[model samples]
Target: MNLPATDRRVLVSGASRGLGRAVAQAFAANGDRVAVHYGSRASDARLTLESLAGEGHVLVGGDVSDPAGAARVADEAGQALGGIDVLVNNAAVNDPHPLATTSYEEWAEQWQRHMSVNLLGTALLSHRAARSMIDRGTGGRIVNVGSRGAFRGEPDYPAYGATKAAVHALGQSLAVSLAPYGIGVASVAPGFIETERVAHRLVGEEGEAIRAQSPFGRVASAQEVAEAVLWLASPAAEWSSGTVLDLNGASYLRT
Candidate 1:
């Protein structure tokens, strides 16, 4: 995993644990100064902070739903590492509730939380990063952590799915607009990842059935998904802009 010495600064949101943690670690392992952002998870943030692969870690704590939070993260990262070269938007909320029985408050809360962080927050940071990249006259990369639920439907969690869909759409538009400025925007969507929070969502046989659905007969790991993000941000994939790489094991096809 040889990374260019020049690509040393990257920002990852929701990096306290799980997929976000893996993405942060991936960049850190390759010698990138990582800004690990967490929303309301101080202890988890501390644990992730300890596990960072490099000394250039900057802890950014904030509510990603806040519009100003993304810009603040960029500011902190710039102050910590001199500049940021990559931005990974992975903060998300996925509390499941059936739409039929879902309360207006629940829907509004989820939308405000997820959309604000996942979509709006991501845009804000990417916007800031783009400005910096333009001023430096070099290309930059924006990798968005999206979900298969955006294209496919889940039994529950309609709000979560919708927000993911919006993320994809937003990525596409950003990719087009940012290209002239030497900025690459892409989305990485994963299917049925095996994470601690999702363990409770499955029963004994239910888990097996879900695994069987994938051609690989297994769920994706956080590290696996993170690897995809790394590649997209890497110079090797410089020409690959506006791409939505589905990291699923052929479980579901986009088209």
Candidate 2:
């Protein structure tokens, strides 16, 4: 099937909820078929699939932290969607492991988990999707969901910060390597976002302080970040390849 440029096949990892769900919905609203990928939340993924505005969306489940699982995810989504034209690498693991209190074993475990999911998962999936795009000769877009913590630092979750930094670098590397094949790659470093997973932290005095970090006096919404991802994946954004777009609302300025 020859889909219109505006209605390409999109694969959104971690789309079971939160920002991933928002990204999937945005593409579906734009008339694109979406493959909603989930790690463990099958029920939540089904809800996301149902919430999409368009048809032909599918639910794909896999553990992105594992090499085999990541490969399976890309293959399943590609087969179901009839080839992915846009790949959103949004799956990640962000758990706190403070150096002052964490044990060596715990710190090592956290680092391994973060690297496997945030960095390795994104690289493997991008390779799979990019290969498919190259074979199809249609070109594609790869938008990685990085974090502002990559630059501002995550004292409490050092692994997350480090892995996200690596993700940004990985995207830049792939952008250059894949450009000749017509694949555009980019990353979004978002600051604090209001989502179900982090709703508990968005309350009380701590929440107020978090919100105050941005001059806007509020954290970003999932939809807002999703819109940026959507734009990055659009044909008009081809020139934006190799760019790391900051969506922190001026919370942290980099020089």
Candidate 3:
């Protein structure tokens, strides 16, 4: 069975700002009730919640990196939204720890952090949401916010790249496993996106270089990525499950 497009309950993790916020707004604009989740940015999350286009939107907070916290987040969102028809796994940690300059301890810590949040967190949440979807006997969608770095590489943030690659793989695995239960799973691999956190990097020489990476000579807006995600979670996108749609403006091509 295909999930309903509108009036669905959506849970967008790490939606306090940036891409996640844009995704939440898109779903709300499409007539879906959204649960805007935040890790430690309650104030920012409130701003996102206030900016939403409709009512019935809520705010949920928890540390997705922890198993208990992940469970709580999924449970609270499920209860508040009535049931999770769509889940966007957007929460992640991307810290730089270049091998040449960073100490062994720092490298290990970064690896663990990336693994816990980017990989484990997404897996745990997907499991919970999938089980709920199974119980409801209704179709659902899961869209993961993967990164271009998963394929393009991140020398300074190797852990981020590695974990995101793992996320992509996990999404594919779940797509197959959940197909019988009518849960479609997919991921988006976006290149340099223009967000508040990365505003400083989009100026001067660094900014120019980043933009030049794309054939369009500009980076993507959060709204652009959100639109792709919105479609991925739509009823029409069920066939696109297990696919990783790239939104890099011709920046990175994979064979």
Question: Candidate 3's residue-wise lDDT over 1-255, tens digit each?
Answer: 669979999999999999999999999999999999999999999999999998999999999989999999999999998999999999998889999999999988999999999999999999989999999999799999999999999998899999999999999999999999999999999999999999999999999999999989999999999999999999999999999999999999999
RMSD of 2: 1.5
Across 1-255, the per-residue lDDT of candidate 2 in tens digits comes to 122467798999999999999999999999999999999999999999999997899999998878899889999999998889999999998999999999999989999999999999998899889999999988899999999999999999999999999999999999999998889999999999999999999999999999999999999999999999999999888999999999999999999
In candidate 3, where is summed lDDT lowest over 10 consecutive residues?
A: 1-10
Consecutive 10-residue window with the lowest summed lDDT within model 2: 1-10
TM-score of each: 0.93, 0.98, 0.99
Models sorted by lDDT, best on top: 3, 2, 1
TM-score, candidate 2, is 0.98
Pick by TM-score: 1 or 3, better one: 3
RMSD list, candidates in order: 2.4, 1.5, 0.6
Q: For candidate 1, write residues 196-253 as lDDT tens digits.
A: 7788655688888989879999989999999999989987776788889998899999
lDDT of each: 0.83, 0.93, 0.96
